[model samples]
Target chain A: MKQDQDEFYVGYQPKAPAGIAGAVRGTVVLLLLLGAVAAFLIVREQKDIAAALFEFGVVREFEGVIAAKPYPMLRVARPDAAGDAEAFSRYLLVAPFKFGADPIVAPFDGKKVSLKGTLIYRDNKTMIELAAEDALREIGGGVGDKPVSFGEVTLKGEIVDSKCFLGVMNPGELKTHKACAVRCISGGIPPVLVVRDGEGTVKTFLLVDRNQGQVNQAVLPMVAEPVAVTGELVRLDDWWMLKADPESYKLL
Target chain B: MSLAYQAVGWNRQKKVYDGWLAVGILLYLAVFMVLGAVLFPSITAETLLIRGFGTASFVLLHVILYIGPAARLFPRLLPLLYNRRHMGVSMFVLGLAHGVLALIQYHVGGDQFPLVSLLTSNGDYASVVNFPFQLLGFLALGILFLMAATSHDFWLANLTAPVWKALHMLVYVAYALLVAHVALGYLQNHAAPVTTALLGLGVLGLFGLHAAAALREGATDKEAEADNGWVYVARVDEILENRARMICAAGERIAVFKYEGKVSAVSNVCQHQNGPLGEGKIVDGCITCPWHGYQYRPKDGASPPPFTEKIPTFRAKVTEGKIYVDPKPLPPGTEVEPALIQGEGVA
Candidate 1:
């Protein structure tokens, strides 16, 4: 057939028709430009990566009493403590990846212990990642304080894995991180019900059963989802504890 | 045409096509990665890589799907359709990387097996918006892998053209799954309205292009009127020399070619990949398929010696200054004598 005015492109030909080459070049340029624009849109739309920090590779030594009830944590006494003042600053503790520090700190519960671990923090919350080899060294037995009970209340918020929300992962409490949160919670990481109190400031409450026991296994399906809980809110020094059964948490 | 497969027969056009493809992929990836790192400082390396490769592959898929309809709408864009398998394979590789990285980050080192965790972590399948988007992506990746694995001509030949074509058409299913993945998975959260709008526009645009191409093809595909056994093609001069005028008569698709004072007819469907031969040009004395440059003799509908491809030919004649072709097709590789166009000289 006679060649039309429009250049016919043959894949095996040594040279493309000039008109076809020009068209393809123009299309390629436009595609690249569109790609950059798409990238910009997607990157800009990303949830502002939280200002949380994870000391990924830095380990520091700390001394504190291991609080192994409800969740594993380190209760370091405040340096400027006086009579009738808040006594200890609590830091939630977890092992590497998706596990809570229960197995590591169970033996030293209520005992003053020292360990080398990394710190993860966001807002006012802190969590320590313990080293596997001799993670805890019990220095002495320490007195543990009972949680000061506040009245029962209802709160609405999302359930998030504490390790990731505090800092292991950025922007960690949403559908994007849902599976990770579920995996973490299922693997025994402490789950926190992230909620907003009357003052409108968002706070996280360490979630536990009605008897104040670990609820990691029971709260698996509810992680990273909007939920409402009616529970007794208590304060253990700086730590906020929510006493509620996992089966009672309502999906919202 | 190749006598035996040798991985790929490197042609200058293919090299140029692949070289530009690589450049486009790298440029997009670089922009996404470098810019994402700069903009989202707290994003992890694994997340960055996963999003980078995922977005790049997603973009490549759009372009790849765009080319088929674009080539039909504007023939000059056929060059893009030629090396499309390369694009498919590259997109699959990128998707695989994204899936593997995500699995390691979210599933590995957890309490359960990674794959089981991925499948069982979220039980909200009953909800449309909250359906596990990763599951959609996983299924799409599986489809893409199938298409990519069988992209070679060897597989095409072994599976036969009709089956291979049907198999590759699963790309639409894969594309739909990916769109759902982005919509219900990524956009289910705090996505900007503009991002959602753009996604909607992209889906609409893909459908629009396909509709437009189908509309353009409607005219040629319409059934033609026949007198006795032969059907009217086009006026002798209307079919430019060395070009074929496609005519759909009854159920058969015919291409009537006029060249050098002679007229010949052959099936419009090329033996290779069912490419539209009527849209092709006579190159080096053979009808060269625009899609892959597969050539067949105009008279006998057979590939030149050393290539075994053949297509059905049809009896044709130029009578009263108009070309007509028999609605019935001759056997594949059947040689039909060209009917002389009385007034035309050698073109």
Candidate 2:
């Protein structure tokens, strides 16, 4: 049935006039076409999803030296390293669900421990989300640390929550992921300043105040916004650490 | 159209309408998710669900808004308007899904409560481009929920037509908030041309359709004054058989229907949804409403036996080849004699 101006439609009637029923059928075809077009355009327009991987629900055991400076991290020496590069690979450690691994790993600071956790990695960056309980148990080895200084410099980038950016959330930087970044950072996850070089090479630095303490709360207002910070760039093993007060950061 | 509503009155036509509606929604979601995964192989499942549901609800809102004006311009499209409230409720449910899942994925399991974190997580309230866009979406969802909760005819009857109408008018407010939500939330980061173009087109199309409908309605809204206790209607010949010509007189819209060689006048507002009664033709000896087909006898403005709805009727007469209506209304259900067109006087 078509929508003839002459045919009156009473919805309570068991049947629609043939013309209206036919017109509604035509409308359905039209709507389906519109839906297809919308779906294609919308999906095709998405920003690229990053090639990050989060090995969610697959638990693996690991052994490494714990470090609490700047943020909680595990330093595992690599036997495959060539000649004078950093001897160990630093795996950022975070507790499950929007929290830092500091409290869980702090008791074993500077001591080697074994733990079960999930791995979240992107490019060269890696992080571990520790099991809810019994995440770290000391395996009995002491650690000595030497920090190499890269000198004071000014760099520009967006601040992001390290756990999410490492792999937990794809493209987890800037305004789109700002709220989650803020939540993660506020809950004590390390804040990272992510700088991308002109050629698209990316460098991430664990942000800390001048005292080398956690700056998660201090950097909340700057998370996911492009900003510039001047600080001493130092290296603790394979991890880059930015030593600066949150007050020195400027919105770009 | 309903004597007593029971959740919903199931009719064959209504079942067909809902079945098609479900098909449309499922088709949209399937396309979005399947195509999204094929295109962005690394896209997370949660992100896909969020985007698919969010965009579907937003697009459906544009369709819902378009129906009212489109039906006015093309009355044959009235079937689309018959079950519009169902569409509203479905749109709200989709929106709720998008909102709740996005919140859980982002804000929950954090140190603060999810709602608290949602409000306090962003401090850029003063900046337009940097405003908390999620907050806009949250507020819009709240309004959508309110509307869906009160959508039943039971609420319409309890709240009174005017108040229910006024509450639902907040759809424009909700629409504005959603526009900002998209502009500030997604477009601020993505800025894809197709996304922006679609949003702009929906806004512009709605504006164009409504403006055109309003202009057409303005022509018929011209008021006629009374002379010697009667208001002049159109010529008797102007109203075709079993059809009506509407006139605004005596502070009300009166439909002067000519049927069976005689003329009668009644209030133009239908008892159901206040549909334009004048646009409907006489069906089975009763004046039918164009929207829901609620019927009333032209002589007394009363529904047939077993239907209690009624409207005010006016005394009509034909004189010197012209039709005239008394500028005062008889009580609802009061019977009035039909005017003889050839004899030029009320029978």
Candidate 3:
């Protein structure tokens, strides 16, 4: 085919490289199977029980006093509680009624109310979603706001989403989960401070603003890593709430 | 060779190119995933995949971009330029996987659509700290999809060479978008100075190589002098042994070689991907293409036996220690005796 022809070449053409048909075929099949397995596992793994909780159709009754800070929450006092320092008066109840008027406010504040809802509890964080507007019924007794004391403390921990850290994502707090954690926090998920005391007992605190509003954008950088937070700690309704400025957290 | 298509045209070179490409991708993924798992034990699988594929694609894009200018400076690097489009497509796949996984992980399960959420979630565009970086990534991915879908000879044929070349050049835009994406997206959260510094260094290196090559070519273009029907390329002593000096004349680039006490000239453009043959050396008595090792005889511009590739040859003479080559090119593979140096001893 050797010819002394004067053909004007116009452009560059790619040459076909060596073949790997069998290897390529095998790789495609393997990747397909792997993708299937990965999807199944990712979908199957329980990140949150929000959908399952709604699916249960279970009606729960809670007769408790409501605390109207951060959000309107119920403090269901445990009756057979001993005088132990670790045992708090009541556990705070979270309600999933965002972007609307709170069921318990002003007139219903500090009042004994019996609420009916589907209860979702994971780790130490508990939230309830009402099925109907009339689910929260005011029972007649009224009590004044409990006197709260805020003590300054320094704690080491990672800031994480209350939902995912409680049950949704297993081992969710790390450097690798930084971006996702930031997203979750930015998407209005309440940030929780997960810490270990000197005894190595893991404790969680709902991080709030100075006036106890839900902490969002400010705490994004502190999520998913070990950091030392200096803040005012208030033990209210069986939960420790941390109120601190974003600048107070030091990365460790 | 028609405009009608086959999914892939498998040849010895293409098969090898694709095989190595597949193997490279697999190895990269395996290493990335394994290292991620070991280094970050507390991270979820979703996070690992996002970081893994994201870094892999970013690194691969840089490698793909470097091949062009690197080949220009050194001919031996031409092999990397061959079938580089495959590398490009592979990068897009990895990038797509990363983008999709990240979207699902961070944006899905919300009230809004995932893609919509990605675009709208971070609305603090005015704030540098909270800039909408996901938009950059999405735009980049869009450009990549366009390039990948049209990276075929069929498109080239229909679109015409100049149009196709110009359209494919959007890769630079995609590259710029990806740089901004990483700078704003990943680095914003994970502030590792080493990683950031490395990325900066890579960008600088790319610009540095291109600028250096362009400056060299600019000097060559300015130095070339033409007379009547021939152009002064270089002095006989200017071209190193077995090497060639390239010159542009009469709307064609030519490579004038000095070998074995004789001088010869041929088209500078390689038959395989138009690699600069002047950058290559005469290996085993043939002008070996630096890009993919395609060889041709210096005297006839023809490939050796069992190969039929050819390129145009030109008349070159060394008169008074200065080499001058005719602007007119001879028919490809036409044997022409090399012009001998006057009074010079044979090597």
Candidate 4:
């Protein structure tokens, strides 16, 4: 059926036009202009902005206990907004840190520690400060009583109030039950263990979110074990969260 | 006789060439629009135009490549298959678009100097994998541009047909390079399976169709027959007016046709695929193949429009109530005056 249609017309070779070269040259010039504009727009969209962090500037050798459960949050604030108000306060519903201990006999609420981290100001009321894992160096203890500002320090502490919370457990059930038993122990919540740095002189954290299911799988078996975590120390309004990679801790 | 030859020279009044040029242009524009939507959205208008034009050129080459087979397979497709030189020129322009835009994107953007970057960026010249595929595309495009620039009849007449044909064959080389350019450079980075699959399917499909035609022709070659001055056969009545018939002649099938009150004899097979012209019909004063729609002027057996294939024609004459064919064939691309065959049995 298709071949029958091909028989109708005599094929002729068209003569090439004289001015075709000039027309093509003109078109190419136009095309170059189009490409340049498109490339510029794409590059612009991917650019990053820079801001200042003055108030939470440069704290030397600071340490503290895990005073509160550090829920990851994002705070966007204008530097010159009136009355130290935060422009954007959105909780990072999914915590990015993984935990490594069980709940039954691990550290409870008031763990102590001495650690170093950068203090980033996310506005006056809300500021998240943490010593990133890469910056965790073993600086020697302070000399004399001259109020040493060594810019960096390592935290020494005992495991305190640590229990795995809503993030680690299954979606609906936060209650102490057998269903949550996989993350928790026989009689306690999943370990959100907090270590006290030498008799509660400084407090720090050990909290894990649900997405770190692999770490939870590894840590749930070892309940009541004393461990030391090395990570970036972050401080946020009277609280500090250790942004530690799961590999940075050793169970003693 | 010279006046007659001049009168029979190419009929310029026919708008077949103009129609083909328009179709090619429209197809080029359509391809540009499609590539623009796919590759240039959210980009600056300048980049869009450059990339669009580049893609358009690639499509023009593709169109030129396919037109021959398309005309062979569908005679109605003949009108759309004219204007080879314009099509070539259009393809060259499009090639320029692709080459220049790519150069700006990968070379001249910032701190990198263009020439140094193309030559020395990825070690030595042997590693085409590491070598800038864009540069290869650039070179191929340059060749195409040069060819298009010289596609005039003046140049064609000056240069022998063989040299002209050899230069035109660079299109295939350019196409190969462009394919590599897309596969290695764009597909490697984008990693989109669908786009890769689509491109792969198109190239494979085109090649496969041509291959199928070639294979079919080869299979039928053994049964063809021939004789002196003409191939005397029982199926002479099968030749339709303005149409052709294939007669088996000494292990070769010869195309026999009648047009303008004249009988002409040429090889039965299409140059592209050895398609049986006997099964095809008369279309716009040409004998068209039924299998692929390749058309030939019955007077001279010259391929028309997009077809570049030429077959040896056997000088034919009707003598003493018998159709006789010459055992010797005129060289390919030969133009001969046709002789009329008489009798109601000669369909």
Candidate 5:
């Protein structure tokens, strides 16, 4: 067992120049430690800019009937004595839109329902994002039967998700957050279009199919990207709805 | 080569190599961050770090892959090969930073665990255009982690050289995955033609270098053989005393040594780590492996005694002032008499 190990050092016993491996390892360890410290120091807890932006939008609840077509919309009865269907102010109910019909809103169509969620207000625009479909509860009988008004318009903007844009991810929309935006939309987060006017003021819209159903897969590739979309614009509460034919939206 | 491990055997050259390597990596990262800030002022700091370090590490990985074939093409490049493990570990660090920053910026907001959200958030795997590109990057990073964590001689000794070398080969797999990660993720949104072109050119360059090196080696292995199954290698005067002249006969690399006026031949592949035995010389009358200082008897291809390592031997003869090696090789450790030349006194 104690045989000469030198026998294994056959022919040429090349002793290294003597300082290479150690210096290399020491340098490597030092660099790694420095990098870790720098990374830790540079990256701190980020401020919740999204929350501050959300504070600009006021929150409220509505008792209405759900528009369970291409996407979910709520037709709220006017608090005043206007009894006809025209007396209703329709508001689109936005939630994290997943694949297929939503389990909560799909069953409560044409029935009086109560929507309890945060209603965001910006530039005289109102939009509410539901934490879950359970926010839509049947309230015994149906409410608004008025014809849902629609107007055709062309809009330019970037498609983003309400969850991240409102408060979760700071400065969330752009080329960098594109993949995250795509994931949020695909995972059933309702997509919102942040359109900027000539005055640099911003307005947001919920993007859906022409019939206002889930457009998660249809616009999945276009998330967080700027584009021009021609769609039927509808007014629901303070929320602006863009029911575009999925094929009509073009990347800019 | 020592009987006991002492953590590491240090040398001045190794220290110098590591110092320069560290300086190069830090300088690269610093330049990247500075340039990013100046060029894209509106981008957030986190985004800059993620993209800057991500691209830097990707480029470094390509350079690491290019070093091997480059060294074969030019012996002067061997110094780069000596410190490559340091380069790899540095790359892993840069890559880990990019991955961590990306996770914090994108996936940490939701109620779901960030990793879980990354995997399940996008189920559009069926569409090529919408494939989960992040998954490719995630898997590649995992491979880099494995290679980095085990990148020491201690691991090499425990796992054995062949297995350790094989495990490190997964870098190629990681490279392929990273290519897809960039193509499908950033390029899709940014539409930068120049970046795409550069990626294509880097891949082509690596391919060209490897193919050229392989072709050269193949030519050496195809030299014509003599009628008696002996292949002509070199003239007796061409082999330096105490050194060797390497030859390829019947596809086997043989190192023929000339020492004390006698010639002996053994397989060039060292049993320790497949090091180039031909590059080593006869020291104290024993053949030594230059890589880790392993030694053996030139006559029988065997370790002196109590050591079990052995290599195959070949019959070498000198006729007409030239050295010739038999195409057939003998079993490992088989003893053979040394061949004597005319000018040299009978051995």
Candidate 6:
């Protein structure tokens, strides 16, 4: 085919304009210098962010739990006068209770214990969720009810019934699945306990919250033993919720 | 034929462009190393230097690739096209710095050997949601390094143009790999949406321009083919004073210049990589390619500086107020300088 000789030509040549090579070299040098400076700044910035987060009390400390148990009702009372009396409360309509290894057990009528956890405020109220270590410690022993700071107040309570849930039909009989039911519930939701007043009247209480990939083993064989559960005390409606410290929990 | 038409053949290079390229790259590395050492004391200065250099190099490579296409679309951008290899090599150095630093950071930091860590660190390779894209970047960089290392004419001649071109095409693959690297590694880790978008837009913009050019070429191919052969159909006003527009005939584009009242015809494609000379400007008594600034004297088509390629020139004559170009090509490098007419010539 005849190639056009009157058409526009566009092609690439390896050579550059006079002095442009020098200019490009200079520009690259400048950019490299600038990049080094920027990289240093970025590294410093990351360190600062990490430090700031640490200063803000975001890093949690492991503290022992004083006490724990599952109660029929939970509540969080407002601290101020203007705050609602019943801000957060969850009442268990049915109690499917179980003891140590038993499949079924009776509901926690009246019990009391102190537990410890990291208290976090949400919607203007405190909520406590126990960590694994704290739950285990609380099951071993119970604690006394002392006016503890938001950080170290371990709720102490007796496991009125380890398995506490509504009655469910078994294949053979209508036998209560109490003890084993609590162990099977998982999520540190076993070793159910009841917090009670001086007159033995059931008051607010705490329960175990488990993490993923963990199973609730048999309750501390030392039943009725006092345990210190350090975590956050979350006050709901009629009863207060205690989340045990996953790290800081010990059998007293 | 004109002097410009005869100059479109390959000429041996007096000086290699690679020397300037190497020098520029080394300077960038030195500057990066010194600055990094001074600025970052906590981390090993070498690592920072390498990373900084690599990033800058990639950016420079991108800029170099853009200059050619930019000059084509915008004639004024020709100046940027000059000394592009130096720019490319400098970029290569920077990219090398990045690769070396990344290897040190990812591989050396861990307890395992650097190479082992690079290959076996699959901790973050769980899902597409969090795929380890760095491995892909590493692979792409390896390809770029290979191409950059062999970017000299010596290698080009040995490898042959087709092989060289094919090897260089890995640039597109590198671009894609880099995109994935940034998206999965940096963006995911930093969660910086704005930065991600900006980088994405810059790369996408370059690709978009190339795609647009390809579409335009396809659309104009038929007209170009018709204009390539003997008969040149042009508007009366299209032929400017002393300068001529290239017309496509029979699938070829040819430049027709009217100098001193005489019209001459030559292949519009530059002998050096078929650069379009018709789009070039007549500067300082020479046809200057808008791409890479290669100058050729229009009298004999001889490239002036840093180039020695010659293209075929065709005979042309005006008949009955119409322009016609001969279908036959003159011998390669035939210095057929067309004479100029002194009297009032056909406008």
**B262-323, model 1: which lDDT tens digit per residue?**
98889999876999999988888999898988999998999998889999999887778988
The predicted structure with the larger lDDT, 2 or 6, is 2
lDDT string for model 6 (A97-162, tens) is 111211111121222223333333222222333222322111222122332224436655543222
Candidate 1, which segments miss by more than 4 Å at Cα? A1-6, A80-87, A196-201, B343-347
Q: Taking the true A–B contacts (Cα pairs closer than 8 Å), what share appears in each candidate?
A: 0.75, 0.74, 0.06, 0.04, 0.07, 0.02
DockQ of candidate 2 compared with the true complex: 0.72
Model 5 Cα lDDT, one tens digit per residue, B1-347: 44455554566555665687777666666765665555444345676678768876887787789878875675434455665787899899989999999987777644457898688665367878767788888999999999998887678778987898898999999999999898887776554565667678879989999999999777656655766677887899987777788877777888999988788999998876677787676876888865555788899999877676788998888887788888688999988888887653221
Error of 2 at B141 (Å): 1.1
Give per-residue CA lDDT, model 2, range A64-172, as digits (tens): 8888766888999888898887779999999998887777887898998998999998878899999887888899886768878989999999999988888787767
Residue B185's lDDT within candidate 4 is 55
Q: Please, what are the lDDT tens digits per residue for candidate 6 over residues B1-347?
A: 11233212342221333454555456545555555445443333343454557555655565666655665565444444544555665676667667776564334422345566565443236667445565777787788788877676556546765677688778778877877776665455454454555567668778877877667555434454224445654433457654666766666677777655566667777654356777666655667665545567665676665556556766766555455666456754555645334432322
lDDT of 4 by residue, B176-219 (tens): 88888666554543334655655676588669767765665555
Per-candidate RMSD, Å: 2.4, 2.1, 9.9, 18.1, 9.2, 17.6
Predictions in order: lDDT: 0.86, 0.88, 0.67, 0.46, 0.69, 0.47
Candidate 2, B325: how far from true, in Å? Answer: 2.2
lDDT for each residue of candidate 3 in B1-347, tens digit (9 for 90 to 100): 22247877656666666786786667666765665555444445765687668777877787788878876775334555656888889999999999999788766754456676676655357876556778888899999999899887678657765677788889999999889887876566553565677679879989998998898787655545568767888888887877888888877888888898898999987764466787767877988766545688999999887776789999877778888888789999978788787743211
TM-score of each: 0.95, 0.96, 0.61, 0.48, 0.67, 0.50
What DockQ results do all the predictions give, each relative to the true complex?
Answer: 0.72, 0.72, 0.09, 0.03, 0.09, 0.03
Off by over 4 Å in 6: A1-252, B1-51, B109-113, B123-127, B211-229, B233-237, B240-244, B281-308, B327-331, B334-347
Output DockQ, candidate 6.
0.03
> Model 4 chain B — which ten-residue stretch has the worst lDDT?
B1-10
**Model 1 interface root-mean-square deviation:** 1.4
Hey, what RMSD does candidate 3 come out at?
A: 9.9
- The C-alpha local distance difference test score for the whole of candidate 4 amounts to 0.46
Candidate 5 residue A203 Cα shift, in angstroms, is: 7.4
Question: What is model 3's native contact fraction?
Answer: 0.06
Candidate 4 lDDT over A196-237, as tens digits, reads 444533243433432222234344433333456654554443
